[model samples]
Target chain A: TQLLEQSPQFLSIQEGENLTVYCNSSSVFSSLQWYRQEPGEGPVLLVTVVTGGEVKKLKRLTFQFGDARKDSSLHITAAQPGDTGLYLCAGVSGSGYALNFGKGTSLLVTP
Target chain B: NAGVTQTPKFRILKIGQSMTLQCAQDMNHNYMYWYRQDPGMGLKLIYYSVGAGITDKGEVPNGYNVSRSTTEDFPLRLELAAPSQTSVYFCASSYSEGREQYFGPGTRLTVT
Candidate 1:
């Protein structure tokens, strides 16, 4: 079973539309991270939420971590075609070096 | 500076063939990791090293091996490559064990 579960496996929307992706898990995590990957490249770190109930924003992207540390969300506003990519959520379990990643949400934006 | 660099951006292997994927980081980070991504799946860790001469298995360690002889390099070895091992491999480095990691562009591997 996947330790982290992401909803809306795929999304397609017009430019300027808004969308949100969810990541959930039963286990608590020390921190949660969001990453974005393009077609031929590896994932790049978007943001890391360390504290419970913390919300971070990067331009048009916003990330929120649940107070229980078992869930997180990413919201994008006025999405553009350049924003189209695969979004992944990862959780740092305990003090280990490995991260538990969710299946990921693939977003496609059209003009 | 080059945060992370992986050699052989793409490769093809026949069954029973063996090869090593080289990775190097110039960030002076102490933690390095190897992860594989399959189609429509999340990236799964294969191996990791905290420092030179130290290595550990991650979530997906089968069919793979790793060595860390120096803090700047971590290489992954695949023995008897199989079709199941075909995927995109990524190398990452981080200053701390559970912190944000910088990833390499990735290496695409195909096995026949």
Candidate 2:
């Protein structure tokens, strides 16, 4: 029973294509964070959204926090092969000490 | 600033063997954590420390032990390793609990 669920467990796209990954949960969160992990490496923080309905952008990547603070989404524009990696979303819950992570979405971008 | 550093980037352990995974952070973060990542699964927290001498179990604490004697070091110990323990282990540090965590390169453990 994953507290947070990510959709499209796997994604493969061509260069310059656009993709969006969704993370949903029933419980409200104080904040949501997005991370990217590459093979043989640990996950790196991409962005953190704290307010409901807030949108943050990092380069070609955009992160949005749901109005209810129960979900979040990450969108990548004009994907490139270098963008291939596993994306993960984590929710900050209960006084902000622990993080509950989603199953993660594996992305592969081929040129 | 080295951020977080974990030792033994790769290790192979035989069943029933025991070993310790070393983690050190240079940022002087007060909060430290241990997490394991399995294939196709999100990181599962094993243990965490709020400060020196204050340790707590997270979602997955079984088969693992941790001690935080200093602010910069948090080591994870695995006793009688099992095949199920084989996964990539990551150590993270943060200025505060529930804040953005900085991760190490990760240690890959394979148990046979």
Candidate 3:
């Protein structure tokens, strides 16, 4: 069963354009995380949100965890060519350390 | 320090063959995990270990096994390769639950 669902499986935009991607789930999570994966590379941790309704910023990227703890969103301001990659969202529930990952949103920022 | 490292960046095996995927981390983390990513399918956990000598199954563990005999090494074994097992495998480690995990480059495996 897929616990998490990400929207806009693929996106293409001009550099400097703003965009937002979403991750949603029916089950609440103790913590949520975002990862960025480049071609032929592993997914790298971008941020982790533990509190419901929490928000974090990584330079131009803004991430928010829903108050219900069942959903999250990532907004990129002025997307750049370097930001082209696969963005994934994962959630941790129960007592286990394993992560339930979403199918991911693939973004392509063109010059 | 090398956060996490995997061997044989890419591999191809014949059906019914066997192979081990190696993973090592120098951060001395207590938690390690193995995950497989299929095209457009993010990642699915195969196994995990909280510490050396302790291991557990994750969301998907069919036809796969893992062992963590040391803090720095966690190896995943496929007893019999299958076309269904073809995917990109990644190894990650973290200090503990809810912490940022460091991932290795990944092993792209194809079983024909």
Candidate 4:
């Protein structure tokens, strides 16, 4: 079973739309990170939330960590075509060095 | 710094053949990791090293081997490659556990 589960496996929206992607797990994490990946490339880190109930914003993107540290959400406001790509959520459990990744949410923003 | 780098961006190996995927990080991070990403399945950890000479298996370590003899290099080896082993391989490094990681462009490997 996947340690983390992401919702909206695939999403397609026109430019200027807003959407939110969720990452959920029953296990608490020491830290949660969001990454965006383009085709044929590695995932690039967008943001990291280490404290529970933390909210971070990077320009138009907003990231929230659940108070329980078991879930996270990424919301993009006024999405642009450049926002299209695969968004993956990863978490580090307290006991290990390996990261647990969610399946990912593929987003396509059309002009 | 180059941060993280991987060699042979693409490769194709016949079944039963063996090859190694090279990974190096110039950042001198103490933690390095290998992960395999299959379509829609996200990235699964193949192996990881906390430091030189200290390696551990991750969630999916079958059919794979790794070694970390130096702080900057962590290579993943595949023995008796199979079709099921075909996927995009990513190398990542972090300063410490639970820290943000830097990733390599990745290597696409196909085993026929």
Candidate 5:
């Protein structure tokens, strides 16, 4: 079973549109991270939220961690073709150094 | 800095065959990890090493083995390749615990 659940497995939107992708889990996490991966490349770290109800911004991209620490969300404003890629969410579980990853959200923005 | 490097970007193996996937990091990170990502899925950890001599299994460790003989090298070995093992393998490294992991481009393997 997947430790982290992400909604809207696939997303396709026109440029300049706004969208939000979510990651949910039953267990709380110490820190949650978001990554963006392009085809044939490794996933790049976009942001990390450690506090409950915390919010972070990377340019036009926004990330929010649920107050309960069991969920998180990534919102992109005025999406561009450059944002097309796989968005993944990962959380630190138990006391281990490994991260539990969500299946991911595949986003495609057409110009 | 060539953060992390993986060999043979693509490979094809027959069932029951065996091979090793090489991973190396130049960031001087003591922590190294191996993960596999299936089509349309997230990455699942296969194994990780804390230092030069310590290694541990992760979520999907079956049919795989790992060795960390040095701080900069961590290679994953497959004793018997299976169709179920076909996926993109990624190697990552971090400076310490709970830090951002830097990943390699990945190795796409296919078992026939």
Candidate 6:
């Protein structure tokens, strides 16, 4: 079973649209990370949230860490084709040496 | 720096064959990890290392072996390959457990 669960396994939106993807888990995490991956490439880090209720904005993307640290969300505003890729959420392992990744939300922003 | 480098970008192995997937990091990170991803799926941790001469298994350790002889290299060995082992392998390095990770492009292995 996946340590983390992501909603909307797949999403397809038009340009200039807005969308949000959620990642939830029963286990609490010290920190959570978001990554974007393209075809034939490894996932690339986007943002990291540590504090409860903390929100971080990266240009058009916004990340929010849950108050209980067991969930997180990624919001994309004015989505563009460049935003099309697989978005993955990973929670740091208890030992602080490994990552527990979510199944990922595949987003397609078509023009 | 070559954050994380994995060699043999693509390989096809017949069933029962043996091969090793190589991983190296130049960022001087102390933690390295090996993960396998099947088609249309997320990465599954196979093995990981914290330092030279130290190693541990991850969630899916079966059918895989790893040795950390040096801080820069962590290789994944598949003995008696099977079709079920076909997947894309990725190597990642991080300064610490909760820190951001740097990942290699990947190694696509097909065990026929």
| lDDT, candidate 1, B1-112, per-residue tens | 9889999999999999999999999999999999999988899889999999999988889999999999999999999999999999999999988888899999999999
The residue-by-residue lDDT of candidate 5 on A1-111, one tens digit each, is 338999889999999999999999999998999999999999999998999999999999999999999999999999999999999999987575888899999999999
Q: Candidate 5 residues B11-38, lDDT tens each?
A: 9999999999999999999999999999
Candidate 6 lDDT, A39-82, residue by residue in tens: 88999999999999999999999999999999999999999999
Q: Would you estimate the TM-scores of all the predictions?
A: 0.97, 0.98, 0.97, 0.97, 0.98, 0.97
Clash pairs (backbone) in predicted model 3? none
- Residue B109's lDDT within candidate 5 is 98
Model 3 lDDT at residue A85: 99
Runs with alpha carbons beyond 4 Å of true place in candidate 3: none
The lDDT values for all models are: 0.94, 0.93, 0.94, 0.94, 0.94, 0.92
Docking class of 6: medium
TM-score of predicted structure 5:
0.98
DockQ of each: 0.78, 0.75, 0.77, 0.79, 0.73, 0.74
Colliding residue pairs in candidate 1: none
- The reply for model 5, stretches above 4 Å from the true place, is none
TM-score of 2: 0.98
User: Per-residue alpha-carbon lDDT of model 6 for B43-78, expressed as tens digits?
Assistant: 899999888999998989999999998889999999
How far out, in Å, is residue B57 in model 5? 0.7
Model 4 is docked with a DockQ of 0.79
Of candidate 6 chain B, the 10-residue stretch with the lowest lDDT total is: B36-45
Predictions: Cα RMSD each: 1.1, 1.0, 1.1, 1.1, 1.0, 1.1
- In angstroms, give how far residue B107 of model 2 lies from its true place: 0.8
lDDT of 6: 0.92
lDDT, residue B33, candidate 3: 95
* Candidate 2 lDDT over residue span B41-106, tens digit each: 899999998899999999999999999999999999999999999999999988997789999999
